[model samples]
Target: MRNLQGRLELCSINTATLGHREPLNQTIERIARAGFGGIAPWRREVEGGDVPRLARQIKALGLSVTGYCRSTYLPAATSAEFSANVEANRAALRDAAVLGAQCFVLVVGGLVPGSRDLEGARSQVVDGISMLLETARECGVPLALEPLHPMYAAKRAVVNTIAQALSICETVDPDRSGFIGIAVDVYHCWWDPELTASIATTGQANRILAYHVCDWLHETNDMLLDRGMMGDGVIDLPAVRSCVERAGYNGLVEVEIFSAQNWWQREPDEVLAICAERLQTVC
Candidate 1:
């Protein structure tokens, strides 16, 4: 296992950790100054900007973009909507490629509103991903499918487990072409009894594309906005990292927290400082 102790070079900051409180340019500067090795920016921050120029800026600052924020929702209520969503995802893929991102993260969406067809939604997700695979390959941008927590199954993502995510990859890219894989976030997956085993499976298949870190608050206030810092919550973060490293995942450790009531309210620099400190000691 890699020793992350006192190694800030292994740390990557997902821009959301600063709560989107700062502009993309400032966020890049602060993150670089904070001595992190990489940064992952969201779609909101990338759209309407000069993408190539921004990519140059990030490269100039010596920070690698670990992954692009996300793709458009895959499961839609109508055929037209699904087609449009797929087009949008293609656009995201192009942007990710232009930005020199390691991969384009896919938050494969949940059921259509007021719909009870869970199986249908899952099928749409699979088909949607299949449609995008060729484009992903053409652009040379890998796809990282992120399975959200089961609590988000109704609204955020139907892909709610690492095993489920890997299954999609296996079905779509049976050869393990490395164009499709999974992004494991601790906040959404820490409760799983099979997490360690799943990580091993993912590693063996060479499908672990990204690894995210954040703690699950025991007394959570809101499902979407109450994430805790690395050591401030209930997750055994170091142990989780051990499982990932032992499974052969030698990638950046991305810190992606969405604490609207807490971390977002603080100064961005302070947040970056705290992330560096926590990553070295506790993660």
Candidate 2:
């Protein structure tokens, strides 16, 4: 809705896109130089030292925060493991707050080893989210439930649909007080038959937290990496963004790629330039 003319003020860069080529701070500076609206960083980049200082750096560079990289890896065999994840998430949330992030993205973990309890894994997800919501609310930062692709269901996320994530949002924070929502990453949802409907539903409920961009490669080299660039792949991004727009989301379209082979090997500035160009022409 913000860019009805196809002018992209919503373009952002996830630092992982250039993770292999540069350090986090340099990536942030490069992203700012490339003219993206925001950056979403992984937790490791901020954990070692002064997060507020890094926050100041990001702010001074005139870039905004889309969300923090990740939080939820809750599924564990032992109660101690679950509690440890909760504490880790809480600490991640605090870092997000310090970075002045709008939301903290949650990549709910997969099943415990040797376990076939999909339902139990989901239960752990729900419980973990419920526990974290209060801290998220207190910090005035939202918790973004990223429904990873079904390909990741075995070891990444139990909630693999926009419908499922929204259901959690309703159950945990029904008011949609902007405290709970979904991160709609196009790479994960473009293949879904129910995606458009889900986006519309998310819009009506105001549960769309952050929108991420990346192309899904056709060859499918690796399950965890091997993402495609915007125009290089088959995704109709503008159409997807339109669905997100229709769903009442006016957030940054954060470009997140885990391409171990392609984008990561390129120079950081070159990658940013391509991301910007692709955003304008194709996205």
> Each prediction's Cα RMSD?
0.8, 1.4
Runs in model 2 lying further than 4 Å from the true structure: 1-8
Which segments of model 1 are wrong by more than 4 Å?
none
Question: Lowest-lDDT window of 10 residues in candidate 1?
Answer: 1-10
The Cα local distance difference test for each model comes to 0.92, 0.87
Model 2, span 103-203: residue lDDT tens: 99999998887999999999999999999999998888899999988989998898898998999999998777889999999988998999999999988
lDDT of 1 by residue, 163-266 (tens): 99999999999998889998989998999999999999999999988999989988989999999999999999999999988888899999999999999999
Instruction: Tell me how many clashing residue pairs each candidate has.
Output: 0, 1
Measured by lDDT, the strongest candidate is: 1
Global lDDT of model 1: 0.92
